[model samples]
Target: MSDTGTPRMKRPSLHEEIVAEVRRMIVDGELAPGEWIAEMQLCGDLGISRTPLREALKVLASEELVLLEQNRGTRVAPITFDAMLAQFEFMEALQMFAGRLAAERASEDELERLNAMHREMIRLHETGDRSAYFSLNQEVHTLIASAARNPPLFSVHEASAGKIRRARYQANLSYDRWAESLQEHGEFVAALTARDGQRAGELLSDHLRRTGIAVCSALKAFEDAGERAPDDRKGRAR
Candidate 1:
């Protein structure tokens, strides 16, 4: 702890806690997409007051994780084909930019760190642990972005990440798609290791485009099957 001799903060604010919990619930399917969030029910489950919960919901809404209807309550945002495609277009461009920068600028130490992360991801993928694999995959990509040392690019990438995380999660639901993702990631790491910026950028862009197609196909199937439930809980919270 001698780097600065300062104590690290370990506690999160009430709003932060609530926000994280709610986001997890949404992303993990504890709260389904398009599901209406009953205010009293959720507050009771979390044992929190309305003030902090409302603040948290407001934050999530801004991130597009939740929809706040005027004179109505909050609901988890529904996933749609068009919305997923739109987000992926932006994400793909940013990822390509980051990949090029990372290949050009990542230090040996940084490459070692990313290689370690890539190994873990490979292990998870081989074991068919989709959830854990996806989580690590996100970290690997984030590390690449960080290694790029482009603050503005990282800022935009981080913001887009929150909105598209759920879509990315859903993209790998198909076994074939998941396997393809693992293969793509392997090549991506290889490109990074070789310091091939152009190759890395191309791989990253292709990876994102495939993910977008997967998500759109899945959403279309859901729509065709009429499996999506209508949100009926739409009134103002008491």
Candidate 2:
């Protein structure tokens, strides 16, 4: 996190604000992966006590953003590139099934909901809002999961979303890519409308796997630019 903390008015509980800022720091690469976040120093810098800081740390720890060893204190958990690749694989299978289920069960209302989200996502593309676009990208996936009406599928998708959001935001920076993703969603919608389960499944799985490749490419570019991730880059998502 920045030495000066969030750098805004801090009238809230202080803990929440600090946690949000620190989380953003990790998400935006300000706090490098695997770096230890010293509670004492952070408390001193933010002019807060240990109570709030520890609470904030526990929250992050639960989210797997950081690891708390028995007595070694907290360090940012390494983002395993392989684990991320594995997530993409799981996402492929999960979303394919979701697509098939959606094809079978989607009502007019459900299709309209997905379509409305796609329209808003398109608007985000025009405005060049990468973050917003990724958020909607997440919503669309989760909506499909929910529409599948399978609690287990919904749980698994929700669990993976935090990691997926990071990868998506890191990769889909260009406006052209956002437009392309919108078009992909359009294809998904078309399949759903046509009641084509197998085709929809293929499209959904391909969409996720391709997006994983995009993010992996971006990660490789970062490493080539003379930076290091706390994660391994040992394989191709292709």
Candidate 3:
């Protein structure tokens, strides 16, 4: 309660802000996966001391976004194909359930809000604002999950979604995939509008499956190129 007797919004503490910033850095690939975290450099960049930075890192470690190795120091967790596949599979199941529930439970106002968000996402996409589009893209998924009216399902979805956000973002880097994703969302919205739970669920799941394939393909290509680079260098020397 505030002094005026109205409930006051509690602001996030510095510790919480640090955690979120670090998490964003990792998710946005500013802190690359498998790259060792330079604690001192980060502390200097963020203008914070080691104590709070370490505390923030511990929280990220718990989220499995960072690895804490004894003596080896902390590094951003690597995004492996196996892990990406598993995460997408898990998310596909969750989204399918949520899509069904959302079609059944979402109110008119909520559905309208989702439509509005979809419009904004389209605008962002057309303008080539990828970062903003990606953020709104996640928001669209979040809104659908929220509309499901199932707390336990939403909670689990959110926790898992955080882990795979980077993969989802990276999957959109392909122009074809990005455009296809928009078309999928359009169909998804139409299904929701018609209150067709089955169609909505299937569409959402298929969308995720495609996204998983794109991410896995991209990761494989990247790893293959990295491996070939050394051989190419040796050949040039010979």
Most TM-score-accurate candidate: 3
Write model 2 residue lDDT over 1-238, tens digit each, in one string. Answer: 3577856664766777978767766655555567887889878977888888888889878877778888788887665556678878888888899999988888889888888988887787777665566666777888888888888888778767666654544443444555666788889878987889898989999888877777666766765776654332211111
Clashing pairs for predicted structure model 3, backbone only = none
lDDT of 3: 0.81
Alpha-carbon runs more than 4 Å astray in model 1: 1-12, 170-172, 229-238
Write down the lDDT that model 1 would get. 0.78
TM per prediction: 0.84, 0.71, 0.86
**Candidate 2, residue 90: CA error in Å?**
1.8
Put down candidate 1 lDDT per residue, 1-238, tens digits, no spaces: 5479988777898778899999888765568788889989899999998888999999999888899988878898988878877988988888889999999999999899888987887787677666677677778878888989999998788767766776554433566777787788889889998999999999998988887777777667767887663322211000
Of 1 and 2, the candidate ahead on TM-score is: 1
Where's the lowest-lDDT run of ten residues in candidate 1? Answer: 229-238
How many steric overlaps are in each model, in order? 0, 0, 0
- Give candidate 2's TM-score: 0.71
lDDT of 3 by residue, 1-238 (tens): 9889999999999999999999989876678778899999999999999999999999999989999999889999887778888998988888899999999999999899889988987897788776677777778888899999999999888778777776554443466777888889989988988899999999998888887777777666766676311111111100
Sort by lDDT, top down from the best: 3, 1, 2
